[model samples]
Target: MKAGYVIRDQERPHFITITVVDWIDIFTRKNYREIISNCFRFCIKNKGMILYGYVIMSNHIHLIVQSRDGKLSDLIRDFKKFTANQILAALHNEPESRREWILERFAKATETHTRNKNFQVWQYGNHAEEIFSLKFMWNKLNYIHLNPVRSGIVEKAIHYIDSSARNYADEKGVLDITLAENPVTDTRKNSEFWKYNSYED
Candidate 1:
């Protein structure tokens, strides 16, 4: 299979989205989400990944990330590969009621691509876009936090524990994130911050 798209620059933080094949709600489970969170922590510690912001949704994840070692592409590629393998292992070894169906779906997804030997957990292409301006950065940042809210999963962005919104909201969260050098204008106070369509392709 062809390699995923490459980033033009490693110095700039990029907004990336990683989605499950067929839009599977794999992260609905606590353990599955934990796997992702644990991987992020590991990457930050060992892989020179600097996660500025992130959010884990039922079927996808959004991240504002960069690499200190100028290996953003390498870090993302490995992160996906590692998470897919670990999640696949969990599917087989863990007690999931939808085990058979999930495995079959992943296997089916892989059959369409030569790159995957057995199963394909994450769909190819992160849909990465470099954050070029402070306005754009804040836009993506707000979009990440507001994802759960837009999905009707939460009443407020700060209420979503799976996202870095809590950190921006001055609350402690599960994963640690590097704050942006530019002070984040109060998103809550500014309704215009979230008015833009964040999911545009």
Candidate 2:
């Protein structure tokens, strides 16, 4: 939890990365991915979370998000707590071949921290980076969308079903997201418009 990565402004959108404990590939399964999607939907509908972009990878997820009620920290805390319990319960109830292994890892992760009662699912601290400018916002959005492609999971970003890239491409994604405007195009236009209109003495 570095000071730079902490979420300072609750109302501003921030790019966040939430990783699984020990970088476990728990989200390779559809059920696990669905759990994440459902949690996001719940937050959006009930927790004042304004999700702008997201992508769920095998071991982690990236999101560009804000809080409508200016309580982003609380929303993130609740999301992590609820999702961790649901995922742990699913591992116990579902037919997972790697159940024992995964559970052992989660349990081991909690050994260093007394706060965890039994297991720790997610790695602490979301590595939150606030989106300061329009260019930075678009940069983060593109990064989130292209993560799967960069990881060799999909050829095109839109082909990834677990990402908001599809939504940006005019296709339905797993969960709804607030589509961010393309600031690069707008910036270019603005620059061109003001190129020759500067006041000179």
Candidate 3:
């Protein structure tokens, strides 16, 4: 497991990339995709975090986000917890027989997580890498947008229905959203230098 996300160069906001437990492909189905999308939509609507660019790989998700109105860790924890429960319930009650096989996979990956009653839908580490410079964010954004292309699944970034690539490319997503400003620059990203106000240590 990755070490807990540290405030690397805490002078700016961070870009976090988290993977599924044991690289389980929980999102092979559309119902799973909807669950993840709902979590993103909820975070944006509630003004808890700024949803930037993202790409959904088979087993992981990448996000460029910054905390607002509260701690970033809490926001992510809530998101993971909610999605895990909802997705798990869907596996149980949603009459999708294919889900039985998926549940078996999830169970296998979560064996270690189930110890001490932990619901191990997702891996524990929320891999956060702070993004302080524009150049770095630029690269990360392009990396995110081009993930599908890199995988040879599609020739274009917007072709993937599971990503924010369409929104960033100025097309509306099925879920609907205004484009997240490209190059992902903002006061939030630069607020780290003065985070002393919110710092306790």
Candidate 4:
């Protein structure tokens, strides 16, 4: 487990990256992707987790998140644990073509790591950086939203259904995220940062 990047303030928003074990492309399937989306909604509604921005990539996910109940660490821990089990079940019970291969891979990953149980679906540590200022927040937000665009998955960031770019673009997205309050930079309709604020692309 990585000991670095501790959360000093549980209520403060942080940019987080959760990656799959061995960087596996587990989310290549639509079902697996939907599983993650459902988990996000569940966490938001019941775990006191605040979803600010997010993007689900093929093998990992980026999130701008905070907690209202002062249980950010616990929430994330449970989220990973639950998703791993749920996804493993899906691999076994669903019509996955690479079911056997994927299971073997997960099992192998567990054998080498003492922290894991039967299988290790997600990596142990998350790359977390606290969002302290408006500029930093915007920069990370743009990076998350533009991941798919940079990877050639979409021409526009808003077109990616698995990201918060749709929400920022003023469209009803998969998960509803709270816009940051009192952005240091003016996010008004006529402001210079309006294009990036509301995600023009």
Candidate 5:
């Protein structure tokens, strides 16, 4: 599908969530999980977006970020595209020498899908929802941090390893995460007025 229907503004605060098609848990393997973490770094180092908080669910991901230098939509698109190809390649040539079993699991899942060659690591399209207010931003942040808790992965937010909950709570993580109140929209209450509106044609 074209981005026309799902397109969103990049340089704006947004509450974004993306899911794998059919809820496939492609990131259950640690190696694949690392790939996702790298995506976060790629965005930040490039000065595209600031990731406020996030959680990597079995098959889906929930995130809160804002585009500061570039479009958040383009950042997400690039991340997904780069990761999709990378994951697929790893599953093919390298096959995760460290996690061969996990590779096999992926191989088996793609057994029935026509789109996958050896496996389909990630499904495209992020389910993005722009956070338009302080209350809404806080709510979305809490929701993302609680994703693991809601899924029974951890009782406390800080314990979830593959999430940004720790960073928000002042705990150290593998990546440098800047946690602060993100400026919502350029126009306050009019925030919703421009959310998801692509400034770019």
Candidate 6:
């Protein structure tokens, strides 16, 4: 992992990106995307994950998350391990046209690493950036929401059903997320900061 991408403050919310090995577009399948959503639901319910924002793309996922129990790293590790196994199983048992090709890619990805035995689904290291301030938090939130829009998957961010953009728009999303609240006070300095840095999607 790179020095800057390391998670320093486990209790603070961080913007994280987890990518597929070789950037393969495995999540273009609905079943695979549902697996990701189910994992988030499990983590939030049982593992003390406080999910603020999330978006699942074709090959990667973006999230703004913190740990209620101060074990964010552990939570992430378990998530990846379980999700990888489930995805591999799905590729084998489910009806997939490119199952062999995708499995071959995953198998090839593990050739460089001893930790992975049969396959490697996710790439190593989450590019994590700690949310240092309210401005930074909202900036990451907008970035997460706008990812599908930038990819041309949807005209508006909220139209993407796999993202927390729907929750932010006051609609029920596939998974529950804790709505991030503005902590900024009405001081002159903070007012100026918000005026200059307020993010809009």
The lowest-lDDT stretch of 10 consecutive residues in candidate 6 is 188-197
Clashing pairs in 1: none
Residues 1-201, candidate 2: write the lDDT tens digits: 789999999899999999999999999999999999999999999988999899999999999999999988998899899999999999999999999999999999999979897999999999999999977887788788778877888767777899887776667888888988776554542442122222332
User: Which tens-of-lDDT digit does each residue in 108-175 have in candidate 5?
Assistant: 76777676677555555566676667778767776777777768877676778888767755678666
Q: Over the stretch 114-198, how does candidate 4's per-residue lDDT look in tens digits?
A: 8877888998777888898977887788789888888998877777899988777678998888876536444354533344344
Model 6, C-alpha of 67: deviation from truth (Å): 0.8
Q: Candidate 3, TM-score vs. the true structure?
A: 0.77
Q: For candidate 5, report its TM-score.
A: 0.73
Writing each residue's lDDT as its tens digit, candidate 3 over 67-141 gives 776477677777888888898898888777666666676677756544425346777777788776766775677
Give the lowest summed-lDDT range of ten residues in model 3. Answer: 191-200
- TM-score of every prediction relative to native: 0.90, 0.91, 0.77, 0.89, 0.73, 0.90
* Pairwise TM-score winner, candidates 4 and 5: 4
Model 1 per-residue lDDT at 128: 86
The Cα RMSD in angstroms, rounded to one decimal, for candidate 2 relative to the true structure is: 7.3
**Candidate 1, poorest ten consecutive residues by summed lDDT:** 192-201
lDDT value for candidate 2? 0.87
Candidate 4, residue 53: Cα displacement in angstroms equals: 0.4
Error of 1 at 83 (Å): 0.6
Superposition TM-score, candidate 6 onto the true structure: 0.90
In candidate 3, position 41 carries an lDDT of: 88
After superposition, candidate 5 runs with Cα above 4 Å error: 1-8, 95-121, 182-201
Per-residue CA lDDT of model 1 for 1-201, tens digit only, reads 223345789887899999999999999999999999999999999999999899999999999999999888889999999999899999989999999999999999978669998899998888888888877887788889888888999877777889898776667988998977544455445443334322223
What clash count does candidate 3 reach?
0
